[model samples]
Target: MTQAIDRVRQALLQAGHPDTIAMFAEGTHTAAEAAASVGCSIAQIAKSIIFRSGETPILVVASGVNRIDRAKVGAALGRKVERADPAWVEATTGFAVGGVAPVGHLAPALILIDEDLLALDPVWAAAGSPSHAFRTTPADLVRVTGGSVANVKA
Candidate 1:
């Protein structure tokens, strides 16, 4: 218990989101598994995605059930958006691909939130660990991440 809390705290501090950080082990890595562990609907999970627009990296916090439309992303970012590989995700976010949180990242990323997510009452986000996640309101996530809520998909 202490170790989990400590890991979460360190991750939050490193990402500059110490106030909003929470962690718990899900015993699995899939979004479905996480939602089950956290007692939430799978759609409530926000999947963090890292995409590259040339040399610039952008982070998208999208709903679990939606797929990001590349054309829309490119239009929004005003650049060609390509799905970044795991290495790029890790390099840019400091968290593993499966555990990238909305607010805590190794570096500042151009963060975008899927507008659909705002409709959910309590959204779940990763907590810097593949097996962990937490619940928070969409408004709080938007404010803490400084993310612009937008249509991220079709």
Candidate 2:
């Protein structure tokens, strides 16, 4: 495995996940791409969105079918949040835009899980690369990220 993917596997192991990483012959960068690759509903794809809440970085794992509302995010945290740029995202999360995972970030990040994701049994999250992913429950994502569940969807 590549170092990027290896790190994710190690982190999941440390987090007590059941080791469910899967690789695709083709890239699955977008939610639609991932869902098609895994033959699951688009909503089952947990799309990770990182934002700049001032100096703090926040990772919101939301359902693919839902649109993330920045107003809802700001209301939830009592502060406005904007999407982080690619440079900031890579620097803070140690991964590029398309493959940022919910956990194993290079630095500490405040995480938020979409309440809608909890309705799904096996949510697929980007592992470390666009071509890599892992199956997880919404509860597992919450537990691993130590993030709060919120209505982040519009």
Q: lDDT of all predictions, in order shown?
A: 0.74, 0.87
Q: What is the lDDT of residue 55 in candidate 1?
A: 60
Name the runs in model 1 displaced over 4 angstroms.
1-23
Instruction: Give the Å shift of residue 117 in candidate 1.
Output: 0.8
| Residue 130, candidate 2: alpha-carbon lDDT | 88
lDDT (tens digit, per residue) of candidate 1 on 48-94: 88888766779888888888887887787777888899998777767
The backbone clash count of each candidate, in order, is 0, 0
Candidate 1 RMSD computed on C-alpha atoms after optimal superposition onto the true structure: 3.4
Q: Write the per-residue lDDT of candidate 2 for residues 1-154, one digit (tens) a residue.
A: 2666777788899999977889886776999999999889999999988998876888889998999998898888888799899999988887788888887788888888999999998899998888889999988889988999999998
lDDT for predicted candidate 1 compared with the true structure: 0.74
**TM values, all candidates:** 0.83, 0.94
